[model samples]
Target: MTTQATLTPAKELAAKNRARFPNESAEYRQARNALLAEEIELRRHIERVAERRRQLPPGGEVTKDYRFEGENGPVALADLFGDKDTLIIYSYMFGPEREKPCPMCTSLMASWEGKVPDIEQRVALAMVARSPIERLVAAKKARGWRQLKVYSDSDGSFTRDYVSADDADVPAYTVFTRRDGTIRHFWSAEMSSEMADPGQDPRDAPDPDPLWTLLDTTPEGRGANWYPKLEYPSAG
Candidate 1:
């Protein structure tokens, strides 16, 4: 792969002298164009990665009887699948002490809740956590996440097996498939980085976190790297 120099000195100077500071020059134009090209290529790479992830093999039979609850009442892991061929579970980070949802996880979950109908059409979705089921449920209610299928993984091992344990841990989005009364593992995405860019292969960063994106628009600039307390303005 050819590495494009998107951070030439010229680009730096131009960025420092943008519309907010307005000092147009030929060098700046060249640098800007180069940066734009690089960005376009990066986006294309991200699209390819998404496609590749979609094609990954669903391994392991996971028909184990894991039980939990939802708005619809008592549910098993299999029930979450909703007769679909695939099951997608998300390991949320809302712990017992969370007076509010983790900003990043909340952002992702809130978005998922919005996309639930569409996401459900393609894959069964659920947010799992080790917190007590009631605690998790209350947090979800407070967040107004009515559509999301929130569940408790209080046993802890379920999360350990999937590799999402602790606050700093990355939320894991795992996919599974059911066949012959058994479930198989499929695709999984782990967010190890604190600040992720949604751009392409983020082996170095988490995807541009939607929460950060939303918060960044405000003058706070994501507020000294601190997140929004689930209780909101009152939490501080």
Candidate 2:
């Protein structure tokens, strides 16, 4: 059996895949075949990028022993890792100045809440916010996020240093690694609106949020006017 490294070209593999619907037109089938070719290339590119990311050299070592308020009490950056050497921190946009959390961030976190147990098996995961611990807890409860461990960056040290320098009401995904008693920054999502293509939203390739992915399969394709909301007024 040929492994992926020795497999046929993506286009060839894509062309070999055949499917037909009851009443689909010939033109539709032809267009779909072309789309499938591109999809196969996209999948290959994603794997290549992931391989490069894993090969990256060590990132900058963390200097500040940032403190955070967890559910139980105060905890340091090192403590968040527990027994795991890697930690993935998601900066929640629920800062003190904001009356409510960012809807986009909330939407992503809601999906992550269900995957926490599976995700934590390899690396530690924590959701950090600039709000006080109590406020963070309240928001978590309100959203019914039971699995995600929430923490408060009460001093804004970690947020400012790793997330944003100005404490912007923005969400960020960052990863850190610990080795030989030294913790170092690993990687973070740096894609921004400035990097977006014309007519496309600035988002990471193969977005972490499953919402957009699921929508991409539909006819509307993640409609521009629609967005996830914290709550929708119930129909009276």
Candidate 3:
């Protein structure tokens, strides 16, 4: 454990940064250095939050054997873990009533599709929905996702219990851990629209979506009105 007093100050480290661009102005450099210091502090804060999450006391034990329909056949919550002890389930907003899935959810899933294999190296990952498995599989095929595993919470039991009691079509990210024959609820991204700042949208800290992260680095940032779409006019 590195002590705070012994660690180099973020501002000092930022000052030592030698990165320079061609024809950069002094005012820009000064402002950028200050921003860099803040970024460094933000990184440290993120790590601290992660460590605190890791130290959290054991979560509630999962008693119900939630069932889901996978691409091939039926599977239980425990079976989702596969060979890993930790399982991450992303419940996207794809229910029976909607003709198309939620654009935001689809965007996030698209970003995660390619990284599924890399992510599974440490924990099992599954994309789940309340629609039928066939519909979910069709969506997966349409998206051209090769590695991401899709499943259907056919009965909406899992969604009602963990995601929303009203069973509203919403996206949720939940993690469960299996150890010593016991599966327990783990950390979840609980931040919602209600918790967001006045101008910002609901999002988790150290956001899992790379799109937003990338946009945040730009001058426009993530615009208030703009959002992802299932099909773009320019995509063709």
Poorly placed runs, candidate 1 (over 4 Å): 1-25, 96-100, 164-170, 179-181, 190-208, 212-224, 231-236
Error of 2 at 9 (Å): 1.5
By TM-score: ranked, best first: 3, 2, 1
TM-score of each: 0.68, 0.94, 0.96
* Candidate 2 deviant stretches above 4 angstroms: 1-4
lDDT of 1: 0.67
Write model 1 residue lDDT over 1-236, tens digit each, in one string.
Answer: 22353434434444554442267687867666677566655665776677766667757776566776565566777888887888888887765556655676777677667878997787788888766778877877777777887887665656766755444345677888887777778766655554555542233222434665566457666544355444455665
The candidate scoring highest on lDDT is: 3
Of the two candidates 1 and 2, the one with more favorable lDDT, higher being better, is 2
lDDT-better candidate, 2 vs 3:
3
Please give, for residues 143-204, the per-residue lDDT of candidate 2 as tens digits: 88888999999988888888899988688899999999999999999999899999887898
Kindly provide the TM-score of model 2 when superposed on the true structure, using C-alpha atoms: 0.94
After aligning candidate 1 to the native by TM-score, how far in Å is the CA of 39 from where it should be? 1.6
- How many steric clashes between backbone atoms does each model show? 12, 0, 0
The Cα local distance difference test for each model comes to 0.67, 0.90, 0.92
